[model samples]
Target: MPPALNIVPFVSVDHMMRLVLAVGIERFLTELAGFIEEDFRRWSAFDKTPRIASHSPDGVIELMPTSDGTTYGFKYVNGHPKNVRAGRQTVAAFGVLADVGNGYPMLLTEMTILTALRTAATSALAGKYLAPPGARTMALIGNGAQAEFQALAFRALVGVDRLRLYDIDPAATEKCVRNLAGLGFDLRRCASVAAAVEGAEIVTTVTADRQNATILTDNLVGAGLHINGVGGDCPGKTELHPDVLLRCAIFVEYAPQSRIEGEIQQLPPDHPVTELWEVITGRAPGRRDAGQTTLFDSVGFAVEDFSALRYVREKLRTHPFYADLDLLADPDEPRDLFGMLLRAGAGPGRD
Candidate 1:
């Protein structure tokens, strides 16, 4: 351990899969949601801003940054739904957690999978506070990469044992159904989004189209439908109809950011919406009655990533699914920085 003080821990894709499988996905999502809830409770203690995005006709890439006074974190992620035509994933990502006191990264890990996990966890966490009591069925409108994770998270955290799935592509629906079978889910693969929403207490619109498409129209949403709107996460990309947004009691991660990125972006800037932290912290009302509709306008905020990074770092203590990288400079004398590199060539092992 020559670089014990300078080594950085890296969790590659294989290692992340091992770590997650070792801890069951349900248990992992449950614990991760708990961490998210705890951080949201102390929401005022951290720094947050809208993610910076570079948009394109194909897709978008973003950098989401956030920090508590003691630690800093950020994620580099991209969304290219059309990439599937080339057999590529719609989203790929990685993130870093750094020591604010020293300004060095303590963890660098693959976030493509982690992002799916966190997004599901955060959605279910919001549903816990906003969904109607004893809610069981959820309509998962987009059966892409994220649909399976969202179903499992709702099952684990919000008691959604039944799922009604619909996707524009029946192949995608087949893929979701195939993956979720034997998981104790009462699943229905529907041909239309409207048919999927029938009799379901919750409706989650996760379509990845890059425009203002109406995945959930005004007439489609039921009176008390708890909407987990996760796909409308960019400036030009939105899923809910504007009228649907107006009728629901919208809750957002951060108002300023959500106004630009979340479904609330469809409404005027001055339209009132509540910050979710207030409801989680008991300062605001959630689902005033079973008849009132509620929406969690999630744009995948930086604070949730901060909490996710913290969770992985803690799990690293006993989890050996990490490799060390020599990422820092260390010298016998703090001022003799050049000597370290010079000695490397002069050492016994030098070629």
Candidate 2:
């Protein structure tokens, strides 16, 4: 049965967890990546722009939006490194998918978990095309809330099982290790970023800080290694050094957005970069040689959120993981909104 015009499907956090658990996390990520890749292949068909962000001393809040003609979507997300100190999540989000014809919302869901999944999925999807072939070892820096998701997504999509983990706080690293235990990964907790990247073919720098910080220096980055820069997602928040960007053939989700928010923000405005969609679609090259250093400066994009919301909307068809929310006002006569409000106040037998 379909929902009423006034109703929209809402997937709550608990429902989202149940959905992922039911489908299996790795399988969910693998499937979600497929949707993202499908959308990227037709990348030229959608509207694109840099996410709208309002920055503050405490953190940043952003609105990411996109559309592919028939459908439209948007996500509301925030990043506050200090939120964790107050027993809150450092990143939190929610999103909506709507019908373009009527401008009516079709689906609404919490995106905090979804964003983590999509971000990891996007990272691993890039790894599929940009990471060194047969790369099995991955150095995962910044073992925070997103660490385990990134680890799992890589294993599912990129075939990485060996993980070298590190974080500024040892407790966060321990949490990641504990969560990933018995997950068939060869886990090593390294004391430093250099140690974590040592002998690894793919190094992911995902530290959570709002200021310019060098988590990966040029010397630590070796030839032929794929660097997934996940933390440098805002104007001042960066994880890789300028020298590292100069050394690698950089790939990004969207160039305009990445220039403002990705690791490439450190370089000159005219510095060259290949969008990941071009590489995935074979319009551009990725990892030309074995010794080439490739960087996927993954600042989360709106198309990814669009793909994720649509994926969840599709899953809701087979799985009962969502509830119908009365989100729209459907007056009896469409134009009689005030009459509808009057009827509600009239109580029983009002009509």
Candidate 3:
């Protein structure tokens, strides 16, 4: 019999890091943004579903899965704001890419850093359409691990040169500022969310608190401003006031999912919001006027991760350094799955 073939690549966090660094962060974000836009334009071709979530007393865990006929992907992520107190990150994540043809995993990767990168890329992609031209200053309401990436993405993609940073925990803001010190942007630590939003053309709320905290009130929002609502991505966790959502032309990744996780969750089921795919596909208008307020309620969609994974896989083609593991047993015959295990020396009492 021919040698059984079951090959899969184990992509570690380090491999993913090398992939990102090799392409350069800016190029990765730019390419990733393009991939996301392309995927959004073909929204109907994908199998979409809201992530399965498991809630706990401390925080929540979620599994987001999607497929596009050929490939399937899923991410396992946890959100625990209190984890930092235990010297852990507020979010921990990993994901897998699988071939839909035979239901075999092709790659497994740590997505903690990749998630951060994809979130920032998604935000910047939305901002490209929703934010007014010449947008320079951004008010970042929550300064956490995501803050620096958001800052860098905006600077690289949206011409953002100034950042007004604020967090309930001053240490988080300090960490963000320290991370961006040599990146060459003007930074200001704000005393309050309102102070941070003042005079800024873009406002990004990525707070970690898992509650109905109103980070952006209606009154604080200015004309012609774009708001990137990155926090409050789960049910019962909201960051924008109802009036703020009403005042802006809201653009979301996926409306059905966004209505449950984005800031639009505050509104009724019938509340009006534009899907980013519509804008990307030219089915809907974006930024009608310079004076109109725009909002991109970002909940970190699965398609963005799909795009990121595809981009990473393509990058690995040139500089391959991933492990191949036997995650699935292969038999010469398709119906011999059980027989393959037996052939692998799986007798009862055999070690």
Provide the overall lDDT of each model, using Cα atoms, as 2-decimal numbers: 0.91, 0.94, 0.88
Off by over 4 Å in 1: 1-3
lDDT of 2 by residue, 147-222 (tens): 9999999999999999999999999999999999999999999999999999999999888887899999889999
TM-score for every candidate vs. truth? 0.96, 0.97, 0.93
- Candidate 2 local distance difference test against the native: 0.94
Which number leads on TM-score?
Answer: 2
- Among all windows of 10 consecutive residues in model 1, the one with the lowest summed lDDT is 1-10
Among residues 3 or more apart in sequence or in different chains, the pairs in candidate 1 whose N, CA or C atoms overlap within 3 Å are none
Which of the predicted structures, 1 or 2, would earn the higher TM-score when compared with the native?
A: 2
lDDT, residue 154, model 2: 99
Sort order, TM-score high to low: 2, 1, 3
Q: Where does candidate 2 have its weakest 10-residue lDDT segment?
A: 342-351
The TM-score obtained by model 1 is 0.96
Q: Taking the tens digit of each residue's C-alpha lDDT, what string does model 1 give over 109-154?
A: 9999999999999999999999999999999999988999999999
Candidates in descending lDDT order: 2, 1, 3
Q: Which is superior by lDDT, 1 or 2?
A: 2
